[model samples]
Target chain A: MQKTLKSLSNKDPQNIILIGNPNTGKTTLFNSLTGLNQKVGNFPGVTVDKKTGNFNYKETKINVVDLPGTYSLSPNSEDERIAKSYLEETNQNDIIVVVADATNLKRNLLLFTQIVDLGKQVILVLNMMDLLQKNTQEIDFKKLSKKLNCPIIPINARLDKGVEKLKEAVFSYQQKENIFLDSDSSSSSIDETMKRVGKINTIVDDCLTKDGEDKSYLFTKKIDNIVTHKIYGYLIFLGILFFIFQAIFSWASYPMDLIDSGFGFLCDFVSNILPKGILNDLIVNGILAGLGGIVIFVPQIAILFAFITILEDTGYMSRVSFLMDRILRQFGLNGKSIIPIISSTACAIPAIMGARTISNYKERLITIMVAPLISCSARIPVYTILIALIVSEEETYGIFNLQGLLVMGLYLLGFVAAILSAWVMKLIIKSKQKSTFTLEMPIYRTPRWKNVGFEILSKVKIFLFDAGKIIIAISIVLWVLSSYAPGNKFEDISKKYTSETSQQQYSEQEISTLIASERLEHSYAGIIGKIIEPTIKPLGFDWKIGISLVTSFAAREVFVGTMATLYSVGDADNTMSIREKMMAAKNHETGEKLYTTATTLSLLIFYVFAMQCMATLAVVYRETNSIKWPIIQVVYMGALAYFSSLLVYSIFS
Target chain B: MGKSLNMTLDRLKENESGIIKQINDEDLAIQLLSMGFVIGEKIKVERIAPLKDPILITSGSSYISIRNADAKNIEIIV
Candidate 1:
């Protein structure tokens, strides 16, 4: 027992926390230490990112947690509160590793001094020493260490220099007497801060030497001149956005096609090999089809995150925010909302999470509320098919496809709808909190490719796991609802179809197809679809389309699969696919053609304005920590979709 | 401390440096203070937005962008 207690006391993994001001290369340092061995979770009851990783240094295992970057311990934002709360939770085993940008030492030291004043065990890391060297600046590390009574290490985190020395410091650290800085004034916290700055300035003067002026700022300033120029700013920002959309669609198309067809082949193979039973049907239709819905979106999700992380890492997002603040503020959005709103085009789940950075509460709520209206990638399949049905392939002007242009116009309409909703919400929600525009503009630097790649992989993992779980569950439930019905309805359909197969001398494939379609039309899901048909009839939708709408509530892109199944049975000729079946659909009563330009346009508008995503609603609830907001979101978006679709259908039909 | 020495940060031109003397907005002052915008330190205007409302300033290598209204609350002396 005594030996076990001794081992437990001495061999427990040390909790080493990395804290620093933003843009100080702290994350880079954490990455180098832990590599891919990291656990990313949210802090308890909060959505703030908590990343912890394990690594073995010598004989000791250390749990290194990368705290969110903050300027001071006095928190002004949720991200900052997370950092402060975790730091205040300081156990005796906790050791703080504070990272400071060497090129900006005096300012970075302010946070370090505050941590030291709290008597925390800290090892100061001076990062960006390579940039310092380029500018011919030198620091007296030994003298500074003696004065601060802590080990000071200079390392270029990007290049992995001086990492070994940091490890040695962490292993050999011993508790020393806390030599507190002088309390020069009894006035206020402001005075205390002033005194700390005075101390940092003196230390900077004595231990630091600069031989030449830094020229990096000039380049940033020069770029800002054009990028933020009033007329040119908007144009350049639009150009960047155009290029981003182009890249997402073109570059990701190949992998997306591969994933789609791969899932199809797997489903077919499994169906053929497995015996005709409930399990076989469940595996092919329920599990594999549901999983395929998520896997196909992977390439698009990956490319979207890569673009965002690159923009963030290179310090260009802040510039875009700065340039957009004036326009966005008028529409009741914070400048930071642009990132989330634009990203929502790729997906709304992460877009809502991205709203955490907006400091103002009201602005954040507004951003989250309108974000999903931006028409995400799930709507792409719906739009592509609908647009093609309306506009023929020959209707292209030289290099531009008319159908592609229509899709672009739909994206723009989504943006317009989102902005308009934000405006209305601004008028409705009453709050006294004033919006503040105090953003930090980090110096421009080349993005770390490793970090960007890691970011994409991690975000993709979050989507694949979190949203993937909900989507798979919803689809499985949907499959069961569509497959079975009360009172032996499916059994009756199969028996009726079997007798017809024998009497008509139908082929084996034709018999199964007829049975499948007859069963689907009689299932509980089909009945629910018929029930909602009256509500959506004015929107120019039939019961078959109604079924697609019901199934796609789990995810918008399911409309395609739902339609494919509904149409496969409708097409007696057996040559037409989903798209062709949709094109050939005709009204039973009027004998007029369905899928007219007006009806297709109405469907597009409805999708653009509707909150038809279950994952987004759940995420919104999780993020806001309130059921009220998400309910309100659904009701409002649904009303918007209904009214807009009605108006379009009325005008065009 | 002279009355004539009181000049809000918004009045400071590009590349002009000042020492903060006081701040009119209490909340803004506390936030700016903790972020190295203390009364004694020097701050220099680095850049201005194209519309000229939000401007970037540097206080000891830490750059911050604040709107003109917020900047106007910070009283300084050139």
Candidate 2:
């Protein structure tokens, strides 16, 4: 015994670990106990982070490690490996928190008994107690504690109930006499164990009483009857998706306009107060305009996430997964792939990170590669502006606005492209393991508002922080590039314009327009745009459009701001909207219409598939732990975009 | 005739339960058990949700949900 113990100790350090099944509110409990005093670190050699939070119990500083949630410690997947190895290697865990769904106690206790055999301290937290009332089930806590030979605490984690009792119980925990395996008894064989288990069942039956039939299963069944109905399930799913898109487009309009107008008002106010200088121009035009371009889409992003969060929280997402399994399998994806695919609509970075949850490497890689093909919110502002410019708002099919339908079609095109790409990738990458899809359909519950709100706020904040920084920096650089030059052209225009009228005669718009055009024509950016003009000419884009495309590569929405700045610089009248100005643009040499249907379609196809954002690439690099993948991703996506646009242009022209 | 294994619903019907003889795939089985399908536990199939996917089972002092695909993998005693 001493030698065995020594060998185990030599293998790994002893530590206390928290273990639980997924969706058991384990993370919630961990958060409550640890609060914000937690740090995340990777395990010695693994990419998976080891989260440790300090908790004090009876003046003893306990290092609480929140292990990844797994169904069993049987290490089938990487997540399970970390959890199982940590428990097996660590002998010093003072206590183990076996969080179980209270509504599903029988399934939860399997792990409970396994932990008991480990001969360590154990506490069972029966989470989601509030769910029991709806199911009309009651638990005999004392009886459960006696049967398991551990303290049983009932908890409603979302509401913070039973947390104090849980903490107090942990502090006061005293190890009871250990249940030892009978040595020298060959009765520990599988057959003998089964007989022993039968005896334990008798013990359990005596200790616990249940009230009412299990309604959770019944409720889920009733809902699934319609939702999973052969034809109806598919239709309802489509209907739900349609409603979500409608809500995103319609509901977010008011808040988006408010934010847009608010920023415009602020810019005007700042211009009125500050003396005219480069600093003022930088703040009002460069910083404020660029930030406003990105910020206005927050409402649309928030609404999209809210619907998704509610669906996921209510456990309907799993059902959707189940429905899509057979279809997704054909594309070399499983039901789990639906999550990343759905999340990609918000931003490809988090969607790529979400692929981490997919247990299969091949599937995960495929998902990461193709996720960006889904049109994200970053693409929305660009698409919105372009659609408004190209597609008239006349009624189509009698009831549908042609513009709305065209926007919906663009979204559908991206979806189709993503599926087709995944299918092609599936044939390229080979896997031998028999892939299986297994998910626990959690009981449906009303989505907790706090959880939904927290999710939306965190996602929005991350988007604003990461994408906002890149946009601001790029905008300032672009401003400087388009503001100054090494030529008499800018100086000559300023001098001519200022001398042509008295200082009191010139309006702010007139003077600014003259300065803007003169500076832009001789600027470094303008020189580069002219150099790239030959390449973009085949696609029917002028030097100005080429400049906007180059900057928009940082983020798709930056295209609108780039165009706005470009047009604002050249337009002396300053009376028309950006859309009208774009419509009225003509080629300098031939006086031909620049934005013909052929060029518009070609540009639309280009934006549809291009790897446009550097931030997304950086995130992909970080998540995949290799620059190789992001580089490969950018090249493949760019080639696809170029060739696809070429094909579309040739056919149309 | 073999005696039935007294296990939770999640472990039943995929095959005959024989004292849960040995949970060969321990990690996967343990997860099923922790959801409340433990050894020496009595479970009954409550119902299955839409698409015949999520199976609802009753064990310990409560009800729980598990995917049907996962349920088929569980070896149980009848």
Best by DockQ: 1
Clashes of each: 0, 20
Q: Per-residue alpha-carbon lDDT of model 1 for A1-653, expressed as tens digits?
A: 12343345465667889999988988889999889999788778776678889788896887889998998877777788888888887765568999998887877888898898776889999999888887677888898888778889999899999987888888888765464576655767766776777888788778875545665577787887787787898898888777766666567768977987787788778878988777876676666666775677788778877887888899888888888787788889988898898778778877888787788999999999999999787887788668779887557757666665677788899999899999999999888887888888888899999898889889888777865776666666667777777798877777776685474888877787667666766778778877998999999987777877777787787776565545544443334545677887776447688888888899889888888888889889988889999999999999999999999999998
TM-score of 1: 0.91
Error of 1 at A14 (Å): 1.2
Predictions' DockQ, in order: 0.63, 0.24
- TM-scores of the models, in the given order? 0.91, 0.80
Give the docking tier of candidate 2. Answer: acceptable
lDDT scores of the candidates, listed in order: 0.80, 0.71
Candidate 2 residue lDDT tens string, A446-492: 88776677668767876688678877887888777777776666777
Question: Considering summed lDDT, which 10 consecutive residues are worst modelled in model 2 chain A?
Answer: A188-197
